[model samples]
Target: MTSTHADAHILVSMTYASRANPNVSATDFNEILQQAQINNAANSITGMLTFNKDYFLQTIEGPRAQINRLLYILISDERHHDLQIIDTRELKHREWAKWSMNYASPTEENAAIYLKYSTTIGFNPYLLNAESAHGLMNELSAQKG
Candidate 1:
């Protein structure tokens, strides 16, 4: 079954990646995540966020209005730059039904997972295509559980 919002016919999912702004600190990222959790829960959004010190790869699923608002906020947020949208599609169901905002940090333990989808020596999400990025998020989310 499909869920509808006033602004959209059905639920949708969006994936995007961005480079962390140089001035953003760990504390800043923490604050961002906290705020996202609160806002996303209130808006009935679910997603996963994968980030390291360098970049952020995220996939959010929800009503189109809420997703559009979040994308605008992300574009305006100073903590990240060069936002690259990987994909957006209507969803019959959410991929992240259980998470308001699941978080993952790619480290040595998950280097192989990153490499499986990454073209660079490290976790550079900019090099990933839509399918690879989605696959990476699915793998990370499974590992997270």
Candidate 2:
């Protein structure tokens, strides 16, 4: 049976640190995005990823089991650290249903969207709460495709 957002088991929103890994080059980042799109599509997962110089804030929604599985993988992945689940709740609709993994990196043209949630216009996830984190992801997702 198919599931609507309300019928879905979970909707998770999280923010995490990315400083645990070495600087990612464009090739490496693109590779990660490619893999995420493939994997997320297969698993019925949908999310948006927003990254700046220091942190990664993502919002993922899908089956509870699948989300849990992804979370496990993320925790074990050494590419990032300090995974923080900022919000978890049942929702009526998926905010990012259009893409398996829509992503955005702050740039000169789009820094404003990413910085709207930050107090100092810096892309620091640590200074944000669950609401702001979700907002940040939403803004980033709206930046481009």
Candidate 3:
């Protein structure tokens, strides 16, 4: 069934671990980001991704079913496993409207926010706050020719 958000957007924070696949590397990650952008452009979905070591934290926003379907595909993909739902909320506006997936390499600054949320949610925050999390993404965009 198709689901739509009339006055708000559904936000989902999820955590997953890579499957130790030999094919899964930084380049593969970049390709995933490109694919996400294509999908988001067509669907008007938005989100961000943060990675620390082998753990991944992501937030997706869109129609409820669309976001859930995307998450399902991500969690079910063979390249990742141990999928966990960290948090979910309804937002009045789209936080990452311009990008389908903003990617960040986790660092000390970002970890602070991730740790705080992790403590509150009883799970390790694989993702940082949207504010700090976007720094890496901005850097990535700057490097693109």
Error in Å for residue 120 of model 1: 1.3
Report backbone clashes per prediction. 0, 0, 0
Off by over 4 Å in 3: 1-23, 106-145
Residue by residue across 5-39, what tens digits does model 2's lDDT show? 55355554434444436666667667778888999
Order of models, best lDDT first: 1, 2, 3
The candidate that wins on TM-score is: 1
lDDT of 3: 0.59
Ten consecutive residues with minimal summed lDDT in candidate 2? 11-20
Off by over 4 Å in 1: 1-5
Q: Candidates sorted by TM-score, descending order?
A: 1, 2, 3
Candidate 1 residues 21-66, lDDT tens each? 9988889989989998998999889999999899999999998888
Itemize residue pairs with steric clashes in candidate 2: none
lDDT of each: 0.87, 0.72, 0.59
